[model samples]
Target chain A: MIDLPHSDGGHLSLTVKVWRQDDADSPGAFQTYKIDDINPEMSFLEMLDCLNEQLIQEDKEPIAFDHDCREGICGTCGVMINGMAHGPLPNTTTCQLRMRQFKNGDTLVLEPWRAKGFPIVRDLVCDRSAFDRIQQAGGYISVGVGSAPDANSVAVPKKIADAAMNSAACIGCGACVASCKNAAAHLFTAAKVSHLSLLPQGSAERKDRARKMVAQMDEEGFGACSNTNECQAACPANIKVTDIARLNREYAYASLGTSD
Target chain B: MGALRRLLMSSIGKKYVMGLSGLLLIGFVATHLAGNLLIFSGSEAYNTYAAKLHDLGALLYLAEAGLLALFVVHVLYAYWLVAENRASRGDEGYEIGYRSKQRTTYLNLAPRSWMAISGTIVLGFLIWHLIDMRFGLRDNVDPTFERYVDEGLQSEDGRPLFLRYERAIQILQTPVSFVLYAVGSILLGFHLSHGASSWFRSVGLETHGLGGPLKKLGVILAVVIGLGFASIPIYVWVAGVEVGDLSAAEARERARHVSEQALNQPVEAMTAEDVAPAGSPDSDAGD
Candidate 1:
């Protein structure tokens, strides 16, 4: 006898079209899976789990996808659903997208994030390590944690604090990369610049931060921001293009005398 | 140095040129639109207005020279900025994200950045306009003196001038021109919709105390300018004047003759000679 409950459910049936790839550079195809008797309260990722469970019962190979920190903070779970990053909910991450948002008999299309710099790993999984490389290029402050002066030493204005907080909200999601026509990473780089450059802690390395981040962004094969502002719309974090503009200003100033 | 370096090396300079030249061009558009609106007053009034501008002589020459310089600088600086931006990003593409949460709550909900796309379309329409009206139609100037002359104007000599109002009427009467004008006008409206607001923001005129009112004013100005400019071609086409059937070459020859007649007329006859020059050297002098 099947241990799974047949129906605790309000009626919801969904058809999911998921991309399946064995490895990077490998050919990929879409596989259809039917999910039935889903609860309205369950999250969209939960719905995927239900499908995966059914597939496992049949001894079929389970689909591979990325997710961690089911809450929205990690930026780990990003997938394009029906041509939109993070599904239909504006500024809501994939894990936060609840099945209650959809009606019965809905069809969901899922695919890995698309960008020249972000290659697919397997199935719906993609290698987002490019963002890491770019971050490492100089996303952080140079000051050692304990080596820094007293926090009260620098008197940062309230407006700067608010702006820095805004920039600090970026979660490093690659939705911006997937949505952009040019696949520009300006939004991401901008967030990094704004967060650090706005804070007193990050003042010493401000110029280097802008220069290194932009250089790393270019090296990663991302495109330039055309000021389309689409990425600003798709971001779950709701990061602004103003941050990008600030980044541009910082980069401009840095390039004047910097050797690199 | 490369184009990128050249542009960056003179970033502030380019911005000054863009801002100044852009303001000057805006003034020209305003004056040009005001003059064209007189067409609604019947052919005689409009024609006289055209003749007046022609009689300005030295003043008119100065205005044209200023407009030409503004146009050249604006185009050059625009191209330079675009090229430098592209180079800075290099081959790698930039990522853009929609900050739907923040924008909806914190910032103005309107997708104002979409104006760039609208501006590009308007630019294409402007090119078509130059070709059709300025070059192909040769409607703006009387062929006689090479001075800018409005069609349907009388020669300062009091001789009955053969204006190309017939051609203007016929061109406007065509379904193609009417449709083109309508579509172009809509694009222009969209371009101006965001442009007026952006211009204020660029110049640091959008302060918290005045930003809201300024934006509202910008919208009103955009709508007025867009509709006003767009209405000219539309009104001419719809007026249904009985244009005698003239071949394209015949039309050109006739326009040329009318232009010569208007140009040779004495400086005293044109009302434009009486007015002060349209622009001030002191305005753009800061750049």
Candidate 2:
């Protein structure tokens, strides 16, 4: 047999089962496609681009997915890869995932975030405006409109600052909701709530923020936290479930009519 | 009062209720298991405990009402929450299990996910337990046990003590009740494995250092409770070799049969010759 350049382990064949839906009202199902001679060095999104190109040449409707920045930062790229949020790697975004991680002849299943709070927009895109609404409900600290205060004006302990920053690392990608069995958004809401509340700047309305955001989250039809911690496992930011515990404390205080 | 209503109605509030009520139920189950363990202590002890409970009269009725209210609230709230949670994932769930799974379609195969199924089994077991043990329905419990009467074996209030033990043995000895109770106890353990520890997290009692250890402890408690209750029916089946609480001759016969069983012989088929005749080949020589 004649030797081909594919002998370098640079090529792989894969079967992809991707969810396809035209619009919000349409029912979706997994459509399987076989791709050959893939470059393993390609990012997962680039592999998808190859699949779309192949589909175009085959006179079929190409798959629809969302991506921006082609990096892990934007949080624009996300889908359930074999039911895992942001593919199989821990602390990874879909755009940052390389095709080399998967083996040849492996089958991968992809789907949009499945939750009432993040309804499907198309093939692999879902509406995450519920997060925006929750943020609007309270997830912000109000500041007086003037020249910014000096950086050292408010004394924040180094440890507390680090904690706040850690909580603030959440990208609001909706993976936590997709990964949750209950489709609960507790992680996303809790991250924001914790990020603000841990800092003194957010103490003025900390309790109020917790109550309002949680109420909005409930109104969005997201389910309650069952303390499963699948959201913690699935988060790309590696946010802890302790943030959720903190939110619980804040809400309790607020409901008990604590004036701060 | 208005705040209370809203707290009970909100998502976190509803979770608080579920966890609080669930912990309360766990308490009741532990107490019940403790009481049930007195069965091994013989008629006088078990009956004395039962009589003490009965003597409470008005206090017992009041406690029972509270238990019933808690049960009703816990069950109804659970069903409603399940429905609500199921809907939150939209009409369709994930078509495949995640990376660690073997391509199964069910999205979650974790122990916590199966809580409802285990809970349902526990409910069935509870009803059966009440019917056979508490109410002593003639159809459900073997009425044959009522005939195993003895003289002068009465509680402080003259309630027949031997009949209670015999009645329990009669009921638990059957294949149906045995399977029901045994399976129910195991499944209840499975349910509590998740529910017991999760209540801590739900009510905000879980902390970083304590959460992991708390989980292991909860599972251990759950498993122990399960095995403890199941042991009773197993004891009945073992002690049931003779007619439970019967003539002394039958007890002697049972002891002889047990000794023969240790030799692995069919008790009836074993003539004296079959059991190591001097000239016969030693079948158990190596052992």
Candidate 3:
């Protein structure tokens, strides 16, 4: 007997409308799928895997999606389910989103992140290399460790370390971009800027890092922040707009030619 | 010049300009509302304020020039910023627009996505207001106000002389001007509902416990300014307080009474010229 999470001991059927695009240049459309016999215990990704397996059995092309560890740490898997980033589960990745939130007869619409900087690669996958380019631009500390240091060599204040750790939790997922009204990269960029600028080790290049990264972000065709905090609301990492405030502080000081 | 160029070219630098300009404009509107509210005190107080402002001559013009410059800078930068932002979002938007988590949705929310549309309406209304209220050769004005202009107690130099309180009340009660001002104030309220608080965050003023309170403050401020400004027109229209109903003669009587009270003269002893205001220029054109 098959397992079911319902009292009826029957299958859960769902109507899923998934975006299908051939490549970056090709136009895309929504293709509907009628999925039945789904176990309510399956994660959202597992449900997608079941559908892909069914497609393979029918001699059709399996849908392409990006994921590494199904545990949601790699920041690889993401999709818009019913217009919400990461499938309507607040601060939870798509891989971790349980199918229980949805009912059996529900219809889900899945699409990739939409932004000029993020063009669709195939179905439910877009190029986020723009983020890497921004990170490389200056979202780094120039100081070298020269091997391991003693435990007491660096003593970060508890308050400051807590702030840094909070901002450093950003997973570079494009949810911030996906849910932003302007598709701006303020949250992601601010997270990196705040994480490094809060620490003593990153003080040397802090000013230039803020300046270069902001410039690179603008160059990548990302929009400006209107400060709606939509990104903060949609983020899986729970990154706050206070981090953006810190980035603004850093950018202002950098523009003013101030040193640490 | 190099430093100025860098400030203008960068995204954050432009935002700093936007925030500063927007805040200054808020200051202007607040003071303007204070002065405009003097109409409730009766004709004499309002006219004295207007006459004194007009007599400031060059200093008043200088302040007006500065305000216009701020407005121009705010509008121009907004234009460029919006254009670049639209270009970045690509030709296609999400079939569904942005919606955030509703936990903090108890906060007074303005449609942050509709800033450009609301701002455009406010701009149009401002231009129409200048034409309707400031410039002469207009329609449906207070009869005594037309006499003041003819008597050279006021000039047609675009200075609004609320010499008779009816001058303001009458204009507000007009069919077109009333709707225009009402819509303008409402859209300005919409703009400020989100923008009033967002400017600080743009300028990096966020701290612990500040965001929520500032958002609440923005909503309160917007309601007071926008709805408060719109209410006067609504009041006049509803009251049907028109000018032709003993208004012109009443303006004259009030002017005479005010001047006599200031000079402490008897009604029988007071001359006709005593009704002319101290700050008002004598007749250059006769009615």
The DockQ leader among the candidates is 3
In candidate 2, position B177 carries an lDDT of: 78
Q: State the lDDT of candidate 3 residue by residue for B1-287, as single tens digits.
A: 67667756777778888888999999998788788777667666776666666667899889999999999999998988898878877776665554455455433254576787888889998888776666633566544466743433323344323344656766777688778888898888888888788888888887757989998898788888888777767766777756565444454455444433332322332237655555543221111
lDDT of 3 by residue, A70-112 (tens): 8878888898887778876678899988787677788888888
Residue pairs that clash (backbone atoms under 3 angstroms), model 2: none
Per-residue C-alpha lDDT of model 1 across residues B87-185, encoded as one tens digit per residue: 433342212232332233233234354544565676677777667655554454224322223332345454434343553455566677778777787
Residues A57-103 of candidate 1: C-alpha lDDT, one tens digit per residue: 99988888888998999999988877668877778899998887777
Maximum-lDDT candidate: 2
Best by TM-score: 3
Candidate 1 runs further than 4 Å off:
A1-11, A143-148, A226-228, A255-260, B1-35, B41-124, B136-170, B194-219, B237-287
Give per-residue CA lDDT, model 2, range B1-287, as digits (tens): 97788778888888888899999999998998999888888654554466566557699999899898888888888888888898998887788754321122244665687777778778888887887887777485545433422322223344433335445767887888778888888898888988989888787777567778988999999999999999888887777633445653332233223223333322232335434555433333313
- Native contacts, share recovered per candidate: 0.04, 0.57, 0.53
Candidate 3 docking class: acceptable
Cα displacement (Å) at residue A245, model 3:
1.0
- lDDT of each prediction vs. the true structure? 0.66, 0.78, 0.77
In model 1, state the lDDT of residue A167: 84
DockQ preference between candidates 1 and 3, better one: 3
- Weakest 10 consecutive residues of candidate 2 chain B by summed lDDT: B251-260
Report clash pairs, candidate 3: none
Instruction: Give the Cα error of residue A30 in candidate 2, in Å.
Output: 2.7
The alpha-carbon deviation from the true structure for residue B118 of candidate 1, after best TM-score superposition, in angstroms, is 4.8
